[model samples]
Target: MTGIAILPAGRDDAFEQYKQLIRDRHPIEDIGSYLNDEDLELFRTTSDDDLVHVWGTSVDGVWRNIERNDIALVYHDGAFVARGQVLQLRHDPDLAEYLWRKNVEHGRWNEEIPWEYMAFLTDIEEVNVDIEEFTELVGYDKTYRQQGFTRVADKRLNQLSGEESVKTVIADLTDAGEHIHPVGDEDDGPTPDLADQLQAASTDGNAHEEFEKLVAKVFSGLCCAADWIKREAYPSPSQPEAGGRPGLR
Candidate 1:
């Protein structure tokens, strides 16, 4: 089963360092020449890595665990601003040139580093994963502090505090249901209507009554992680595949 993975974009305005490096690589004074000032500011300020080319030399193992088609979230400040699926993992210079050159020209990304490794993402979507809601559900575990890539097992997630509260927050958001899709996933199929989904889940003809079940269905992987833990408490006859995250492996 596919798992959700989190990655830190940067803390504070540290991504600014990367922006400045991009400027140094390619000399461009007028940032507005490529995009408006507001967009330029967003590119510099946001930690969303929709088409980000990262330095992946040391984190090869972590990247390996995050297989293609698994979901990835780019997190910064107190929420996740971007989400995508791993499309490809490669060390191709041509791919880097095509993806980064435009951004470099627009003063958005640093110049291409041919030797740097990268993970390509597709179907990138932007969403808010509120820290308060997240903390209430999972408590303050060391798992959140993980950098690079951290995969939280469903079983581990079940150990967090306030599972009901997390479900409530997810239900509330789903009720307001906004359509979210990545840039290139136009052909993926019709986006499900949140209200319709909730209604289908309702058995007693009450909207609120069905919400909890819908939330559980949506977050089944997270809510049921602990069931796997309960069944297999570790040191089994056969060791399962080691995943990302520090000590869990």
Candidate 2:
């Protein structure tokens, strides 16, 4: 099984309301089909078995490749803020009402797009994965910037399983509350600051040029040494230029 990282927004700062709905054990499904007893029951049910729901138009292919036991990682701001497993996935347009549209005024639905694939994520575990460690292990550098769920690479997935920090966080999954940690906070030590610094450095305009320059600087001495050895071993057939070695300008 693979893993996906998703970003959930709260109607532009209505996160508290969204949290309340999730805490109430609501399915977040559209209520248009209340005529169906099964749908109503699902809407009313409070037992999620630690599952969370994630959906988006961009996740159609992602959910297709995802299986029941595949991992789901959540990102907020710049952190890998939570983790869960896929319990089920479906494309139910009628259930779009179930989506939390806190940004919309009362009784309005978010019609930015039609209802798409939604994944029922269970076995939820919260974690605070630094972006650097996350990218290093997951092989995705800009996970937080992704709009929807992204498939985890197989090689990176194996590497993640062996990570002690990730294991420590995943092993402590006893409740939903455990999945949260402070982001960019000094109290959490220098991790957030370091992550921010790394992000800035990576996004800087001259990052690639600087990296190339650094590489050349580190190897220039070796090249010089090699040239000196060649010059000492053999004499030049022709005289050198006024200020440079033979065959060199």
Worst 10 residues of 2 by lDDT: 225-234
Tens digits of per-residue lDDT, candidate 1, 2-89, equal 4455666564443342333221222223323543465445434432331232323234555566666555556666676556555545
lDDT of 2 at 96: 46
The regions of model 2 sitting more than 4 angstroms off are 5-24, 27-58, 101-112, 142-145, 159-249
TM-score of each: 0.40, 0.47
Q: On residues 1-249, what C-alpha lDDT tens digit does candidate 2 reach at each position?
A: 345535353244433432432223233444334235653444345233422344444346655766665656665566555666665566776554455453223323556655356665554555676556656545666543545556666666566655232323343432232221212222222332554554565456544433323333333433421111111122233542354223111
Candidate 1 at residue 231, lDDT?
11
RMSD of 2: 23.0
lDDT by candidate, in order shown: 0.42, 0.44
TM-score of 2: 0.47
State each model's C-alpha RMSD to the native. 16.7, 23.0
